[model samples]
Target chain A: MTKTRTMLAAFAVGLLTSTAALAGDVRIMWYSDGVEGEVLKDLMDRFMKDNPDIKVVIDNVSFSVVREQLPVQLEAGDGPDIARLANLKALSKHWLDLRPLVAEPAYWDKNFGDQADWMRPDGSNQISGFMTQVTLTGGFANKTLFDQAGVALPGKDATWDDWAKASKQVAESQQIPFPMALDRSGHRLTAPDLSFGANYIGADGKPAPLDDGAKGFISKFIGWIEDGTMSKDIWVSAAGSTYRAGADDFINGQVAFYYSGSWQVPNFSTKIGSNFDWVATGSPCGPANCTGMPGGAGLVAIKYTKNPKDVAKVMDYLASEPIVKEFSERTLFLPAHKGVIEKGLNFKTDDAQAKAALGIFVTASTGLSDIARKLPGWAWSDTVYGALVTRVSQAAAGEMTLDEAYSRIDADIAAKVKDSAL
Target chain B: MAEISRQTSQRRIGQSLGETAMVPVSLAMGLIDAPLRWVQKTFGLGGMAAFFLLPNMLIFGIFVLLPFFINFAYSMTGGTALFLSDRTFVGVDQYARLFDCANYLNPNTCAEDTFWTAVSNTGWFVILQVTLMIGFSLVTALILNRELMARSFWRAVFFFPVLLSPVVVGLIWKWILQRQGLLNFGLFGFGFEPHVWLNDRNWAFAATVGVSIWAHMGFYTLIILAGLQAIPKDLYEAAEMDGTRAMRVFTRITLPLLMPNLLVVIVLVLIRAVQIFDEVYVLTGGGPGTSTLFVTQYIYETGFAAQLRNPGLAAAASILMGLVLVVLTLVQLGLSRSRDKKGARK
Candidate 1:
């Protein structure tokens, strides 16, 4: 009886040891805006099933956690094997170059050719990550309000003034509180800034101080806030570089015109639910062109990963055409995959408004200026963004004049750039 | 004889129940007793006490003192890197940047304008908040000290906000003061136009201060209340026998006796008011163009929240703040000592 019991114990110990040896844990620090986390989980499950030796753990967190906390973890060399990051330029050094481990480098190069620069170090051709979703900034309007107020919606080449005039008329007629409301995000303001001919990148490809066009955009925005065309509560009420979304106002039909990005489409469609008719419009033209900011988040492998091959395998599976297509379709994201974009995703949304908005934003992305495409890659973009938000918001809040705001923005960015050498 | 038997059986049951409870405790003690006995035999009682305390001391040193030292070291360095090796040692440069103002009194003339703006805002906030908090807390404590209907219930009601999370308190106040919120609704019913309470800079600051006072006045009141309860009733009775007027008795007896407690409250409230962040952060976000910004907010933004995570600059700012706090604490201790000496003399 003792010998038999000893044999049973040995068998149990052996089973546990073998299982532990076989299993390799790959933790992916993830943050989500919508249903993408669920989609990624499903994809990861399939990958794990095929490669039974590997296990993937998704550490789901908030956007702010990803932005603030993950960097500290990475700097300490205790970050996850993989992470989903938005500020790619800021975290480019800590990203693992999966060039050698990837099954086929050609596939990654072809699929993520333009986005590779964003994930890699300056002037390096390495596959650090892939864009999960390519986002563009634009605006949506309350079509029902426009119709009721007898104001015609502007055409594709319509200028900022045209939209402003139309929105103001509609707001006055319908007694809407905010004629126009914008999210208090510097990134959100990029569309109008670029449209107004902001030269964020100088001739030398360095981040230039706010040009006349950028100042023009700020001036117009401040003018709107002063004249009651735009609401101060959304922009001026909050201080510093704090982000404030106007989704509530837009959904409640309080805002006739809401300026945000393509990311808000899925949210608006689901949350609004036929409350009012809202439609995505072309980015209003400024002195330069009708343009928008091209930006997105990347799913990256960390440099400190012990299991490079396993991480690569997971990335390969997630970046496969079928998986990415399904992810983009389900999440209603504009696909970063060239093949998926070319084929055109069948967005799995029943809402007509969402479908139309997605179509409009995708087309708008094609017309993004060279400067706009390159702005996301610049190391100093975040510095520029911070200065822009702080100074511009202060000006909008009536704390300082526009000139003081402009001078402060220039000084702040200059000081930051000098201190940023690491 | 039946009652005696019943009592004897109950005693046996109680004994068995206690034994049952002690079984696990005895086993745990037995497990550790051997090691403890060995330690005491090997190193004596003094060493044993130290050995027992070593784990907690090590934890505190590692978690608290180590980080504080590192922060101090980082304050003397410059650069954007999180690690020390990657950072450049620019001794006192960050400090210079912070203090390099043409006119320190006017934040607009300062090199680091935002820091000075925060200082200006925080100075006003600390002065107003501490004064008001102490005054209201004292008044409420005096009121609650008197015999009244539902005194305990009123005490609980006043102390309820103190029990609430700062975030919850901020959210509640924000909801009440928003443009389309309860306050505005009441104003509308009164045939008055709705005021943009949070949008205006002055109004936003005033609102945050008001909410802060309401939320925290209860804690100070509770402290004073305890102090009031501890005061000897004989003193009040003597004052009454002397035919002292109510106001004079309060001034001569209650105020003098409550001085120590009041000082404690003042110092604690001042420190708290200086360190205010979460409540004001959630309420105003230091907004309406930095009119409500505080030093803590500046440190937070410079350290972690900003696009440029300049820990060096943040550490410098924090060290300066620490020096100020240390000086204030020393002053508070001096005053407390003096008060104690006076009481002893009396």
Candidate 2:
């Protein structure tokens, strides 16, 4: 009887202890593009050391989990205390207003103010989150391949055609598999679409149909795939709005030019070390302008967090200027914080190429078109992007014509809008 | 006399212990007895069978029927909302959208072209995959049934792929078929030009079909093998005594006897082909344009994966797919019933 009583008491104590632990726990759902996961871990260790009462746990997952699974969790009113998310604007309602929870709202406003609207709902000044890093879609060229092929790189104001021609020449000389390759992503495609003078946003603030500029660029893109100027493998590798990157082709030196984005700098630096020289070519020019799409992943606090105070504390520590600066420098990411940008960072990288690539992305950020700048904050942007990727990939695979793809994109977007209507 | 008494005491202790262990079980039955008796008395013997099946029925209703009804409910609603309560009712609108084609034959004329494309692809996949799957499985089963050397070893080798996870199967085949994969490497080594097997539409479709058959044929082969072994040895012996040719024996005796199992396999293969997703999804991702896209994948992407997912439309598409599956299941049941009747007559 005494043994039974003792066991019951011990079990009660354990239950209480677990409950206590839960009360102080703050969980973060994180996904990394490059070395940011490691950098974040280091920063989190420091935060945990400084705050002994709170226990911060980071759940590292793939980008797809954040994209596909996190939304389901959020809709069910269950998820991690915090999440590093790309689709911030679409999921704004599920974000906790850190304005009331954080230490100083003004500090967040001053440093991360520019991107605040990107993660929050329109018509409200809710401090939902801060951008972890600013990203710009651009092109990366295999400089070593060009030099080996005895082909000169295109000038700064080079059009897409010029780069394509030069890359084709280099590929022919060096016997590379792909002359040029673009990521199988709508965000990556949008930069070129914008450069070709496509405006996604209509006058009524809804997504417009694919314009002549978009069609012209898309037609040319498909033509490139047909003529072997652009790699057909990546574009037709998957169906639907599934994201696939041509970074591996670029890293393996199989492609002469790869059109991805700035987030790939650390990835390329680590994977392609000393194998070949590479350079970041800022977005190629089109008829209207040479502009890249500006977007980033935001670290937002989830509203469903049981321990809101602890979550706020963790968010505060991570969003601090010093932490953000260190994270940006160490990870070779473009800082989204205005203060960090102004202060200037001596990036912690041995690779001279990565540093130069960062500089190119920074320079490219300044040339973002009005539509590109506004798109990251738009609610319907992802809807538009999903439609674009699904149909364009189909068209690229010769399953449908470009005209059919355009009509489908418009119909898909319209259907989504109608479905979303209250 | 003393030894006898001691043995008797030990026996009593053992019996007591057994009785003690059975006390709770006895109590449990006692607790159930009154309710069961009441049910029997109220509804007779026919209803007693249903009463005995109550728990299973409840489970089936909760897990299967309830969700199916909820899914139907979802089909009638419209919204980006995940919860039914948060969604708006738009009765049959989603279905209308799906059937909104100007020309039923051409997917491009349809409002939901991807859906029609997926339907068309699924139709072709079912027809081709089922036909080829049965043919290969039968051939393999026949070969395995023969008294060949290392027969058991061959059987294990044939069945090995069936044990592997669909994802693993897909990844394995992907490694063999990719641009820089072993197949291309082998071709290059053999003084042949390497071809992109997955990038072409026709080749990609064929890969999905072939890979699926490779992954699943073993199980079907095993089933057919069981059917082959069940056939009486006397039939084959009589055919041999009459000097029947191998082809004649197979056609006259083996094929007729195997018809029931073949029917079962055909229905199962058709159902499985229609529901094919996991291995093929991992293999081709319904790619080279929607050439390999199936109904299941379309439902998944629309319901869960896509940005601003339209669960309503996915639910509607799923309902249509479910109806097809239901028809196939009914056909299976009808075939089995007919087979049973024929067996009873025999």
RMSD of each: 4.1, 3.9
Chain A (alone) TM-scores for all candidate structures: 0.92, 0.99
Q: In model 1 chain A, where is the ten-residue run with the lowest total lDDT?
A: A199-208
Each candidate's chain B TM-score?
0.85, 0.88
lDDT of 2 by residue, B56-166 (tens): 999999999999999999999998998999999999999998999999789888888889989999999999999999999999999999999999999999899999999
**Clash totals for all candidate models:** 0, 0
lDDT of 1 by residue, A1-422 (tens): 99999999999999998778545889999988778889889988988889988989999998878877888888888799999978898788899889998988999999888788877889888799899999988889999999999999988898888888999999999998889998888887877898888878767655787888898899999999999998788887666777788888898999888888888898888789888899998578888999888888899999898888899999988888999899999999887889888897899999999999999998898898887888888877877888888888888878789998898999987787778764
Candidate 2 residue runs with Cα over 4 Å from true position:
B1-43
Q: In model 2 chain B, where is the ten-residue run with the lowest total lDDT? A: B104-113
List candidate 1 stretches off by more than 4 Å: A1-23, B1-64
Per-candidate Cα lDDT values, in order, are 0.88, 0.92
Candidate 1: CAPRI quality band:
medium
Say which candidate scores most in lDDT.
Answer: 2
